[model samples]
Target: MLIQALTPADKSPLLALARRIADAGCNLSESRVSTIGTEVSLMLLASGAWDALAKLETALTKLARDESLRLVHYRTGQRGNSAQLPYLVEVVAADRPGIVARIVEFFAQHEISVEQLNSTRYRAMQTGAEMFQAQFTIGIPADIHIAALRDDFLELCDGMNLDAIMDPVKF
Candidate 1:
């Protein structure tokens, strides 16, 4: 199940919320939390029975109302075996908007699945230039030729002035 919550930037409330979910008989399988300015958002993947999910819904409703947390939840079905290989993509460039969007667009156009992504903006130590960087775990279908894909991707990256790399995720 996928659960999303927007809550105040405080520790106790989040701990209380976690307790509520545990008390409702749900196990938190995975979770990510990020804070932007004053507010924090959380995404949690939880597993539980149908009845437990219902109970959790009720509890979360009350928690949201009382603590002013915005909570939404839904059960997530498995996507089945992807039959695709995992590749890691990393990109760095002068800070500019749309860099991430363009990369994602390329993957989308190629019908690739993005399993995970992390991106950040920072000042470069060498040149003090604002830099944007992103890392992605992408799923590539079996039929595609990886060498051809790398060639095309590097060409595009060069055109955009982005230092980029794509390699298989090694064990």
Candidate 2:
């Protein structure tokens, strides 16, 4: 397993690494790529020796020079068995930059972990304005205060002038 953190500016480097992993006869088990502002994180799970990923590291290091891309972090190991907690949050509003950052920051501050997030944008027929909607599946610790989370989220929505709704979901 090779988990890499990178910037979106140097996508080619990531592609190159992926190709190398494939060529090294490794089976790609799981891969996820996401970005918030200029920061991009890639998590990949593969079946093979960690040594098979050495070349990938060197290639990414070189590619980071001119692109100002930073290899934020990497881990080579297997995952331990664990349990997951489930919660869901969804928001809809006019599309604009910084929305993701703001929401993610709030989650971070609240010590909330997002398991899955899907966001989309389109023009609204009535207003012809860019409308955005985001759905987030989060992991809430057993002790987290749900009512507090809801109140805070509503406050955030009011500040952002957007509509936000959070609910306890069965997963």
Candidate 3:
């Protein structure tokens, strides 16, 4: 468990902290962020025992203090069960807002749980339009219909002028 106090107006510091956490060889478990007036609080969970992660914890605390943020707590091993789904979905399209919302909504409607989601934006070769790529690792129940999901995503791609590729997650 890691605690950080920040302000939404100072997002750079928070993001920098997140990056540092990643560099510290700890897997981020969960992040809960809330804002009140000009202050924001972030509660993060990472993998590792307190003693084992002491150096990292101290560094994070120092960084937080330097940024005028508060260090709340430092602990470890706090996370929920992850989905055991067997497939992944990759979607690429022109950069635009609401893409993630729509994709998540689609998955929700189908009762598919997202296990991991990573997205990036880059320049497209053809049109130079900002291209957005999202890779979703999801958990599909054994009883769920794959054909329906494929068809729905296909139709969605058609409507959005994007490309969606479904791939099986290899064990």
Which candidate tops lDDT?
Answer: 1
Report the C-alpha lDDT of model 2 over 30-132, residue by residue, as the tens digit. 8887776666777666566556566545554665564545554355667644454577888899898999889999989988888889898889998899999
| Clashes by residue pair, model 3 | 1-75
- Listed in order, each prediction's TM-score against the native is 0.87, 0.57, 0.57
Predicted candidate 3 versus true structure: per-residue lDDT over 7-44, tens digit per residue: 55555366766776777766667786666567676767
Relative to the true structure, how large is the alpha-carbon lDDT of every model?
A: 0.85, 0.73, 0.74
Model 3 segments more than 4 A misplaced:
2-64, 68-83
Question: Cα-based RMSD of the predictions, in order?
Answer: 2.1, 5.2, 7.2
The regions of model 2 sitting more than 4 angstroms off are 3-25, 33-43, 49-75, 78-84, 168-171
Stretches off by above 4 angstroms in model 1 are 11-14
Tens-place lDDT digits, model 1, residues 1-171 = 788888777742667667877999988888888786688888887788988888988887777675467778778885689689999999999999899888889889888888898888899998999999899999999998899988988998999999999999998
| Cα lDDT over the full model 2 | 0.73
- Better model by TM-score, 1 or 2? 1
lDDT of 1 at 117: 89
